[model samples]
Target: MIDGLKPYAEMKDSELCWLGDIPAHWRVKRAKAVLRRIDVRSSAGAEELLTVSSARGVVPRRTANVTMFQAESYAGHKLCWPGDLVINSLWAWGKGLGVSQHHGIVSTAYGVYRARDASGILPRYLHELVRSSPFHWELQVRSKGVWISRLQLTDESFLNAPLVVPPLDEQAAIVRFLDHADRRIRLAIAAKQKLIKLLEEQKQAIIHRAVTRGLDPDVCLKPSGVAWLGDVPAHWEITRLGRLIKLTTGFPFKSDGFTHVDDDIRLMRGINVSPARLRWDNVVRWPMSERPNFREYELIPGDIVLGMDRPIIQRGIRLAVVKEVDVPSLLLQRVARIRVRGDLNAEFAALLLSGRNFASYLAPIFTGISVPHLSPEQIKAFRLALPRAEEQQKIVEDVTVRTGAIRSAIDRAEREIELLREYRTRLIADVVTGKLDVREAAARLPDEVESAEPARDEFTADEESDPIEVDDEAEIEGVAG
Candidate 1:
């Protein structure tokens, strides 16, 4: 839909450093001139609670996977209606602002704004424009704090920020063009994701077969008493994971001490673990001085860490193998580190934890409604049909060789999705910032039913930035605007 787009015919300087040249007809206005801050408090806190996320704008608090406790009374929380823009004042620079489509209540610390009656801005257009890269830079420059992580965007700063305004018709065109472009990009991403899923499923089948039935297809089967394992190789032994591996759950670290200092030891929270790899993005750190006090929590190469909280996500179980680069890291709460004890192969244990059977074993065992979790006991109690140590190593080696191509294919698909997302981000920035004219392209597009917006979890932050933490805002009563 964004093919062969061209620049505006005439242009003029916006004079705002953040927003450079704009179409000649466009006007630049202070955000306060175009938007009015609203602070209607919810009388009874009965409205649906909302949250502002960096990757997704304003959404229901229930949809967010937060571990924070909810306020007992939300009566004095800020009330917002459809088309209102909600900004996480504390994280505005992280792109934690979006125009809401639902009537809800937000954090008392959030700033809610609505377009003035006479303002020639569309909420949808504003949503895109503010979230663009240029606006992120503007917000970061205006925010105040001692450090980048704690930066806060005050009311005066947000109100004084310059806004690029296109004509009402042009704003609608921009919105339509970007929406169409997003739909196309999402569909492309979905296709790639589907391919990745199939490849992963195929790889899992190979691992499951090898681990369960062994390399010999015609081997004699025994009735494994475990309900999950119907039949295993006659020679295989069924034993609980605790018998072969030592499980260590992380210590309860204080969040107040969490730092962003690069040289400090990284606290390996659940967020840092993905399917088969550890993601250092969104890491929290502890002081190097305190590291000596928690020597037992230190991770080493070949350790297997699993996210006990929400262990199973759409992608897969959040289990990853610790590597050499991930050391100098201390395990944090809600993550489990498994180390080989007697004769189990670390890689083989990882295979079991990452396989489909383990996921099935865990599916029904998760306890908690808002944030499902697995107790260290539950994880240790998992029973696996095991082969002897040497045979386990042989199976791992054989499976690795067989699944190499499939893994490579999955990586390629993932990389393609990343590139598509990057392209979408660039397209939105260019279109909204007047670098590309999408009016003609929008007008030529056929009318179609817009698919439901993709779920927020499907997307990650544009950078390794902080996510919305409900506890960041105190449960204070909001005052009138």
Candidate 2:
């Protein structure tokens, strides 16, 4: 795409420290001069409730993950019209602001603004500019707070920022060019994601068969006497999970007491659990203290950690086996840690919890509610199929080797997706800041440029949710608009 693009006819300095050069025809202006704050409040609280996500931008609140915060009445929330810019005040430093495409009621915590003059300033253009990589650093610097998590973007700090103004027609062209480029990139990623899902399903089928029935396909079968288990090897035993495992609750650490540091005590939360294994990215920490009882909470290699709250992801719940790299960490509240005892093989138990068959056992425990959770008793009461100890170990080893190949393919696809997303970000920064002129590219763009329409109201029964473009950066930053 870059090879086919051309540069501008003329150039000039932007007169801003952060922004270097720009097209000669464009002018540099302070953000305050181009936009004004809007503070309209809905008296009837009738507008659709909306959320701001770094991944999906300003969307209906229910569409995005509200696992962290339950939805309440939207009364007294700030009102926003389509084309207005909405900023997640606390997370603006992470580019958690976007142009709204729906008329809705946003949390009072957000800052809403509209263009003072649409002829020289467009909401779409402004959205791309403020979210550009350069602006991320700029917002971080201007944000006011003592710590990173608590940083806030005040109206005075946000509205006074620098902006580059272009002709309205040029803004529209750039938006169209980027929209078309973004859609193509997303379509490619969707294909890779689909492939990964199929591979996972196949891997689960392999696990379900091995863990339930013995290795020999011709082995004699007998009724397991459990409704969920139709028939198992004649020699296998049907046992309760409590007979072979000891379940422990996670430590209830105070959130306000938490600190951020590399060497501090690592706290494992639900986010660390992945389908294939545990992930250490985005770890939270607690200060190292003198309490000796901490040793009891510390995890050892091969210990089982299961997410107990809002644990479901991508239509399934995933469990993790602690490795040496993940040790020296204490589990946080809303997570369950299991210790193996008696004749059960720990590896086999962990894999069983990670399989698709486990979903049926979990279905009843996860009643539709604001926060879905499983009690310790419910986990212990789960029926377990016990094969010979030697057979259990062999099955674990066999499944590991088989699933490893599937995992490898998924990893390769994920890396490619990451690289594609990086290219998208760079392309946007180059074109939006005048480093690259895509006017010709825009003209040649396909006529079906994606519409930047907000998803349907999640609170309504008659509406069907539309697929929205999820920005890759949303992962690094927590959540934003």
Candidate 3:
């Protein structure tokens, strides 16, 4: 903590209401007291423009990450200059404020304002103040709209708002210190992202190895003679998918037939199956009474579900395994249930379906003009390399053990990344709004702000335009036109 700062006990009750404690000597004031609205206009074809982004603050016009067709025409927008505070009034409640560093036009929705004086209020400090929790609460209290909420902060309402301001020098120092800490956090995030990418690549390699080559590298190899598979263990047989598994089409149940029941039975559909797992959340319900010949479509432990619809088949791959032979679950028409037979291991067969070689084999068989689909006959005829059951189990075990470890590590890193992002948001909210003393920390910050540039101004009124006409006169004019 910085020197000369103490717990905010000495402040009067009215001076500090929501914020539990503050530094003894600090004074509380409203946000409007230090904020002034700056007004300027720009023509549509203004050469230089500036855009404010939710992620990156104010940035040059060309640097924004928006589709060109979606951006403002730039014909009639507001003008902005370096050092002015630009805030999106509509999005201000979400912390959409930043100090501009480029000269250009901005969206009309933004309120471009300058501080009354640098001595009393620093631009950086004010930027932080508007993002404070209390300030956001104020915005929430004042905003009004049926569906699209709008916050209209009048001059009086703004200036009368109060906040605790540290000394001018301390404010600057805090900004500098927080800036440095932010950079470190960002760098750590980048490192974790790179690690994730590398782990994913490793996972792909493991899958490719297990499916194409058996676990024993010492085993003799031979040409599977299948173009997609290329080669396999010498002892393995090249067989059509139909030979190794019984691929059965699912029963078509009408929407009217679906009933809400408190039963353990699950109806598997194309949507229920993702790449590697089953999503049971948005499942359609069916009554046991409606299930005629349910045993014909019942899912068994180790059975793999493959979607036959075009959209779902494109992401077809492997869905999930019936880990337990529990209650009867019917398969929907758009899905194909593959039950391993002959000398094939169910897990190994499922792994093959999830592997690259099988995907390559099935890709060409998908038929359709717009949404490509796979028929049961086409899927059955798909060629694959089939190893003996014992070898298949070994390969599945090896791949699962290795990939599971990598997946666990990746999941942990992803969770850490998410927490870091949340921490970053809280930290910025605190330092920027003066909730925490960050002046001493700010002095140690690196000069450069190294995140991606702000997104370009791409205001789409078609999206933001009001659906209902505000005035009867306007409605009449629209009808007349």
Candidate 4:
């Protein structure tokens, strides 16, 4: 179906600059003409709570991370029925709105809209149309706020925005085509994700063996006393991480003092630390003039940075070794910078942290419900079975050489997944905006049983910088600008 897609034979100007030409037979209608803004309040907060996510659309609160809690008594929360459009008014610019598939209650801060009676718009079709790439620009430009992330899309603005109106039959066809494409894409991505998971597990097993049990299988083994460690080589030392390294928690730099100047020193927030990699994409900068005041927070090459908050995800522990390029960076609050105190190889320590053992140890002790966190003490308390300095260095080298191919394969799979996502994004935009006619292709698609798992897209997967959380105020609490 995807391969045979082509633009409609007859095209006409959409008049809307963002959407140039749509199918000639389709009508471009103002949103208000087809949607009625509804604000019905729940008599009692008895319905399941729902949240609007740019990644997952409207889903039940229990299915996603809960960033905030509801107040006592559910009375007066806004009511949302199945097929109703729920928009997190403050986050609409971020694609934080979608048509609900389940009836529930949402925060009062959200705007609920229903297709007007007799309006030809299909709920599923409108959901895709408004979330298409071009429509995101429409929401961003119409949203009002000083900070881009905080922009609020007023009810009137959304109601006045232009929407494409296809014939009911065509709308159904578009939805079917996109739905089928989505299912196929999900399966492809799942395969890649599974491969990555397997490769990671294999790589981790190698590291765990190298770190816990020395490279030589003939080496002597003895009870290590630590339950997680089980047994280790007789010559190895079992010690807390703090005994071998100096740990420094970041200083609390005021947000107002942060700058965007590239020449300024980069601030390494907890979010900047991903598993095995340091990400500077979302960094803040401290003024060069104020550099001398924060000498202790300065990060140097060979330092290992770890996110103290939500330190573990499904992928692995959040930690990375700093390289020469990562220098000129300062550690920010909730992140820890570690320096070897003696002969411990930094690479070996990183392997220990990145391995499954550290995560298992941290799992039972980490605190916080909405956001799990690691205190400096908790991180320092992790125990590890360490071999001699020479043995540690040798083990690191051997593991790196052995796992190189696995790492490459994981990278290739990740790149393929990225390409698939890009294709999906473009396909939705072209098909929904009428740049490509999917009706004919839709007709050719064979019957497919819908999977119980919701379709995962770029918005719903690893792409979100932060977990979108909802609180009593009906706001997405974890959005990062």
lDDT tens digits by residue: candidate 1, 166-206: 99898999998887888878878877877888898999999
In the range 1-481, model 3's lDDT, one tens digit per residue, is: 2344323334434344455455555566655666677777765545476655444567664444222233446666677787788866655544455787778777666777776765376777666556555567765554443322244544444446565677778677766665555566767776776787688678867978887887777878898888878878887787888887888877886655665465735677664555555655345567776567677898877788875643222223535576564336788787788898888888887777776776787666654333345777887887877777777888888988989989899789867876876776666655544456654445554577455622211111111111001000000001000
| Worst-scoring 10-residue span by lDDT in model 2 | 459-468
Ranking by TM-score: 1, 4, 2, 3
The residue ranges of model 4 lying beyond 4 angstroms of the native Cα positions read: 250-271, 279-298, 324-332, 366-371, 452-481
Identify the superior model by lDDT, candidate 2 or candidate 3: 2
* TM-score per candidate, chains pooled: 0.90, 0.87, 0.54, 0.89
Q: After aligning candidate 4 to the native by TM-score, how far in Å is the CA of 475 from where it should be?
A: 11
On TM-score, the leading prediction is: 1
Listing every candidate in turn, what is its Cα RMSD in Å to the true structure after a full C-alpha superposition?
4.0, 4.8, 11.6, 3.8
For model 4, the run of ten residues with the poorest summed lDDT? 466-475
lDDT of model 1 at position 79: 87
Off by over 4 Å in 1: 147-149, 251-265, 287-294, 452-481
Candidates 1 and 4, the one with greater TM-score: 1
lDDT of 4 by residue, 126-161 (tens): 999888899998998999976554678899999999
lDDT of 1 at 82: 89
Tell me the spans in candidate 2 whose CA falls farther than 4 Å from its real position.
6-18, 68-72, 288-293, 449-481
